[model samples]
Target: MKTQKLTLTVVMVAILVVMAYIPAIPLGPVPLTIQNIGVMLAGAILGWRNGLLAIIIWLLMAALGLPVLTGGSGGIAPFFGATAGYIWAYPVAALFIGLSLQALTRFNRVNFVTILLTIIVFGVILIDLSGAVGLHITTNMPLPKALIFQLTFIPGDIVKSIVATILTLTLRQRFTALSHA
Candidate 1:
């Protein structure tokens, strides 16, 4: 049973890694991608540790030259490039997002959904803020412009959070083990 769970976790994370590569509408510097949804799903469905592990696996793959990032951005260059900080913050984001949901003691259906939504949005905002700082440092731009660039993702992030929350809640109800961490 543990092996089966591990296998399922691996498969789910792998799918998310692939989803990370799928490019979305590139609106300027901040390209809207499904990667955020993947991140949220990892936390929401897998809980904290396993969700973080999934992100770790994906990041390691990207670090190893897999083009798993948005817009085909990959290799070591990206790790040290403008988006580096945001990329680095991803695992942290996932971890916190997971914790925010699971830490809730109430643990009811509605509470779970509420916690998930709160955490997902919080994580997204953290990523956007971190990415904005990364852009400022990398491009040597003013803070105001960097903030504006970050705001471009607001719509997409909201959509991603909603979709991920819904999918995760449905999966949790359907698959009991998935909710067990």
Candidate 2:
């Protein structure tokens, strides 16, 4: 079980790294990257604790100057930039999604679609809120403006959430052990 957890954690970190390398859609300070998809999946598949660990690992590597963020940017500097809020929110979002799904799974009353929707909704809310807060703090931007600007990413986030949901569900069905873990 421990081995499985470690393996999955590493896999999630790898996914984040790979996703980070994908070209981002330049939009103001926060470029849209598919990295959030990996974050969502990490929580859904690895559970909250492990998912958070994976994200932490990835962030640490990036902080150490590895090119693990969008557009191959790295170092501790980005964490203090305008988009830092979104970057820091990844693990929290993953943990929220994972915990929500785990709790829902305990009930066994929710269907897969319901579970997926719940995770995505919570994940989006948490991620956006944290990102907005971070942006406001770092840039001295007004909260309302930061939140409004965040709206621009909603459509893309929804799409990523859907993809993460489908992929998580499919993988969960195929790997019952990992899902339960």
Candidate 3:
């Protein structure tokens, strides 16, 4: 069981890293990437503990100067850069998603509605808000402006969350070990 957990966690981390490397649109301090989908999946599938661990491990890899983040930009620079707020929020968001799913599962309500709501709340809104906050703090952007900027990410985030939800549900059916406990 431990080995399975470790293996699945590593796979999730790898998936997130690969997703990061997909083509990104540079948007000043915050570039748009699809990695958030994988992050949400990690939380919903791996649960809070392993999901958070996966994000932390991936962040550590980037901090260690590996080309594992968006646009091949790695190292500790991003952590302290304008993306810092979002970076800091990744594990927290993952943890929230995982915890939400675990609780939902306990109620036998791990269906589309619950999964979608959690992803929209914890995964989409939480991450985008954190990124906006980071951008505001790091770049001296006004708080309102930063928040408005986050609005532009909503459509994309919604789409990504939907994708993550489908993937989570599918994977959960096939791999009981990966489903939220």
Candidate 4:
């Protein structure tokens, strides 16, 4: 079962990485993507360790010259480029989202809706803000421009987060392992 789970996780992450690279819907600085769904799913389904590992694996593939990033751009260069911080933050974001869910489970009587809402809001805003800050520093953009770019991402990110939350809730109800209890 462990081997199967690991294999499934790897395949899912790989598919997500490819989805990340595809640029079908370009929207200024941020392209529409299913990548966040993968990120959220990784956390919600796989929990911290396995979730993070999946992201790392995807990133490693991208680093290894796979076009597993937006607009099919990938390489060591992108890893240090403008979007680097956001890309790097993915694993940590997933970790937090997953672990927070786990913590929520510990309470045993908490509101599921609240927990999911908090994860979406916190994960999207805080984590993406860190990426924007990195973009500001790395690209040397002014704070205002950076904020604009970050805002561009907000709409799409909110959509992704909500979708992720819904999907996570549904999957958790079906799959016992998602709770990791």
Predicted structure with the largest TM-score when compared to the true one:
3
lDDT of 1 at 27: 69
lDDT tens digits, residue span 24-124, model 3: 88766687888888889889989999999999999999999988888877998898888898888889999999999999999899998899999999998
lDDT of 3: 0.89
| TM-scores of all predicted structures | 0.86, 0.91, 0.94, 0.84
RMSD of every candidate to native, in Å, equals 2.9, 2.4, 2.4, 3.0
Q: Tell me how far the alpha carbon of residue 131 in candidate 4 is from the true structure, in angstroms, after superposition.
A: 2.0
Regions more than 4 Å wrong, model 4: 21-24, 27-32, 109-112, 177-181
Q: For model 2, how does the per-residue alpha-carbon lDDT over 1-181 read when each residue is reduced to its tens digit?
A: 5987899899989989988889999888678788888888888889989988999899999999999888788999999998788788888888887888888789874466875686667667778888889889998889999999889988888888788888887877878865577
**Every candidate's lDDT:** 0.74, 0.83, 0.89, 0.72
Q: Can you write out model 4's per-residue Cα lDDT over 1-181, one digit (the tens) per residue?
A: 4885698688768767777755546655445566767877787767777888888888898899888876777789866776666777888877887787778778863255755675565567766777677778777877677777777777777777777777777766767665465
lDDT string for model 1 (105-175, tens) is 34553454585566556558888888888878877878799889887888878878888777877776777
3 or 4: which has the higher lDDT? Answer: 3
Candidate 4: C-alpha lDDT: 0.72
Please state the error at residue 110 of candidate 1 in Å.
5.0
> Native-vs-model 1 lDDT?
0.74
- What does candidate 1 score in Cα RMSD to the true structure? 2.9
What RMSD does model 2 have? Answer: 2.4
Which candidate achieves the best lDDT against the true structure?
3
Q: Give the clashing pairs for model 4.
A: 21-69
